[model samples]
Target chain A: MTDLSQQLAFVLEIDKLKAVYRQTTVKEDKDRHENSAEHSWHIALTAQILKDYAEYPIDIERVVQMLLIHDIIEIDAGDLFAFAEQQDHAQQALKEAQAAERLFGLLPPQQHEQYKALWFEFEAAESNDARFAKAMDRILPLVQNMNNNGGSWAKHKISQPQVLARNKHLEYIAPKLWQYVVQQTDLAVSNGWLKKD
Target chain B: MTDLSQQLAFVLEIDKLKAVYRQTTVKEDKDRHENSAEHSWHIALTAQILKDYAEYPIDIERVVQMLLIHDIIEIDAGDLFAFAEQQDHAQQALKEAQAAERLFGLLPPQQHEQYKALWFEFEAAESNDARFAKAMDRILPLVQNMNNNGGSWAKHKISQPQVLARNKHLEYIAPKLWQYVVQQTDLAVSNGWLKKD
Candidate 1:
C-alpha cells in the first residue's frame, strides 16, 4: 500500500471511535449519551485550555495530543464508564492495552510508536503533562454530571465520597479547577445529584 | 475570574458542539449522523497521521490545533453542509464571526487571542499548516460518502464534478493525499456513489 492509502486507512479506522458510546450525556441532552469520539475531543480541548493550571509548566501541545489519543483504545475494548460499579478496572485495562496494540498498529511505523508512547504516558499519568491532561479528562464528566440533572451520578446512585475519591487528583495538578470540582460536588449533594450520606 | 475558571467555562461552553450534528454518519451506522465535535477529532487525527504527506515540512502540532478549533464557531452558527445548495454562506459567516467572539471570549485574553487567531488562520487556509489542515477536513467526508453507500452524496445528489471542485485544494497541499482523493473519487464514480457526468 502507498503512504496515502496507509494514512487514509488509519484515518478511516479510527472513525470506529464515533460508535463507542459512553455513559455521560451531552451537556444539554440527557436522553442520549455522548460518544467516545466527542468525549476525546472535549478532553483534548479541555487540556488545551487548562494547561496553565498544571502543577508544573508543560508542553501544552503534547498534553492535548496525549488527551486526544487517550481513549482511542476504547474503540476496540469499549468505553468503560467511570461510574459503572461492576467491572474490574484492572481487567479492563489489560483488554484495552491489547486493543491499543491492534488499533494503533494500523498506522505507519513512526506514528504507531509515537501514539503508543502517548497512550502509555496517559495511562501512567505520572508526568506533569499527563497529570494535567488526566485532570482535564476527569473534570469534564464532573461538570456534565452537575449539568444534566446529575447525569450518570444520579443514574448510578453514585455517592459524593465515591465521586470525590475518583477525581481528587485534580487537587494537586490543578488546584484552582479542583476548587470548582469540590464546590460543584458539594452543590451536587445539596441538589440531590449525589447521595448525602 | 481566575484563569482556570475562564478555561473551565470555555471548555464547558464548547460542549454544545456535541448537539450540533453534521451530514455524515459513522462508517457503518447510518442510524445516526456524526457530530461537529467528533468531526474535529477525526480531522485532527487525520492531520496528525497524514502530516508526513504534506508538500513541505509543517509544524504538525500547530496544524492539529488549528484543525481542532476550525469548526468550533459552528457550535453557535451551526454546521453548513458542503453540498447544501440554498444556505446563505455570507450570512452564516457573519453569524459565525460573532459566535467566535462570544465563545472564545470566555477564556483569558491570551488564550482567547490565541484561539481566535488559530480559527482565522484555518479559515484563510493560506499557510502550509492551514492548507494541509483544510485538506484533512475535506477528505474525511469524501471518504465517508464512499463508505456509507454514497452517504450524503446520494442523499444530496452530489456529483463527481462537484466533489472535485470542492476538494481541489488538496492537489497543492499534499499531492500524495490528493492522489488518494482522486483515486477514491474515481472509484466512487465507478461504484455509483457519484453521478458520472
Candidate 2:
C-alpha cells in the first residue's frame, strides 16, 4: 500500500476504537455519557483556558499533548476510579504502564518517543506544563458535576470529604482554578448536591 | 452547607465525572483511550508543537482555551464516531449545546460567559485558533492509530477511503500536520498495518 493509503487504514483502525469508548457510560448525565474522543477534546480546551494561571511559563503545546495521550492506557487496563479502594492501585498502575508501552509502541519510533514522553510528563506532574495540565484535568470534571448538580456523586453516594481529599493536589498546581473548585464545592454542599461529611 | 462547601462539592462532582471518563474505553490503546482530562492536555500540547506551522497568526492562549472546552459537551452528548453513519449529524451538536449550558453554568455568571464564548469559538472552528485546535483534534487520533498499527481499524473493518475522507478536513486547516499524517499513513499501509483499497 502507498503511504497515503497506509495512513488512511491507520485512521480507520482508530475509528473502531471510538466504538469502545461509546459503549462506556457515565452516570453523571441521565441522557449523556462521555466518550474517549470527546474527553480528549474537552481537556485540551481546559488546558488552553487555564494556561495563564499556571504557576510558571509552560509550553502550552506540550501540555495539550500530555492531556491527549495521558489516558490511552485505559484501553488496556480499564479506568480506575480515583477514589476507588487502594488495594488495587499498585496493580492498576503496573497494568496501565505496560499498556502504555504497547500502545505507544505502535507509532513510528520517533513519534512514539514524542508521545511517550508527554504521557510520562503528565503522569509525573513535575514540569510547569504537566502541573498546569494536571490542574485542568482536575478542574474540568468539577465544573461538569457542579452544573449537573452533583449528578454522579449523588448517584454514587460519594462523601464530600472523600472528594476533597482525592483532588487536593489541584490546590498546589493551579490555585485560582483550585479556588474556583472550592467555591463550587461549597455551593454543591448547600444545594444538597453532595452529602455533608 | 456553606457556599464554600457547596462549591467544593460541585467541583468534586466534576471529579466524579472525570472518574467516569477514566473508566470509559476506546478501542485504541490505553494511551489513546485517554480520559477527557488527559485529552485536553494533549491537544493543547499539539497546538504548541504545531503552532509555528499554523496557516495564520494564532493567539496561543485563545487556541489553548478552545481546545480544552471543545469537548465538555461530550459529557452530555457522548462521543459521536466521526466515521459512524449518523442519521442526523446535528443531533450531537444540539445535545452538546445543552450540556455546555449546564456545565459552564457552574461557574460564576461572568466566568460562565468567558468559558461559553471559548467553547462557542471552538465549535465554530472559524478563527485561526479554532482551526488550529480542530486540526490537532483530527491529527491526534490518526497518530494514535498509526502507532497502534491500525489495531482499531482492523477490528472495526472501517474502510481506508472513509478514514482518509473523514480526516481530510485537517489538510485545509493545518497543511503541515496533514502532510505528516499522509506520511504516516503511507508507512502504515506499506507495513500491512492497514489494508489497501
Predictions' DockQ, in order: 0.67, 0.18
Candidate 1 residue-wise lDDT, A1-197, digit = tens: 76566666777788888888888877554358788888888888777777667767788888878878888898778888786555578788899999989888887787888899889988888888888888878888897777678989898888888888777778888887788788999999999999975
Top of the candidates by lDDT:
1
Question: TM-scores of all models?
Answer: 0.93, 0.57
Cα deviation of A88, candidate 1, in Å: 1.1
Second chain TM-score per prediction?
0.95, 0.81
Per-residue alpha-carbon lDDT of candidate 2 for residues B80-166, written as tens digits (9 for 90 to 100): 666666765678778888988888777656656888888888888777778788877777766766656675565566666666766
Docking quality (DockQ) of candidate 1? 0.67
Tens digits of lDDT, candidate 2, A1-197: 54334333433343333333432245444435565555665566556545666666788867776776666677677666656778788899889778778776665455557777878887877777887887776666666666666866776777777767656767776676677667777788888877778
Reference-based lDDT, residue A159, model 1: 89
Least accurate stretch of 10 residues (summed lDDT) in model 2 chain B? B16-25
For residue A158, model 1's alpha carbon misses the true position, in angstroms, by 1.7
Please give the fraction of native interface contacts (Cα pairs under 8 Å between A and B) kept by each candidate: 0.58, 0.24
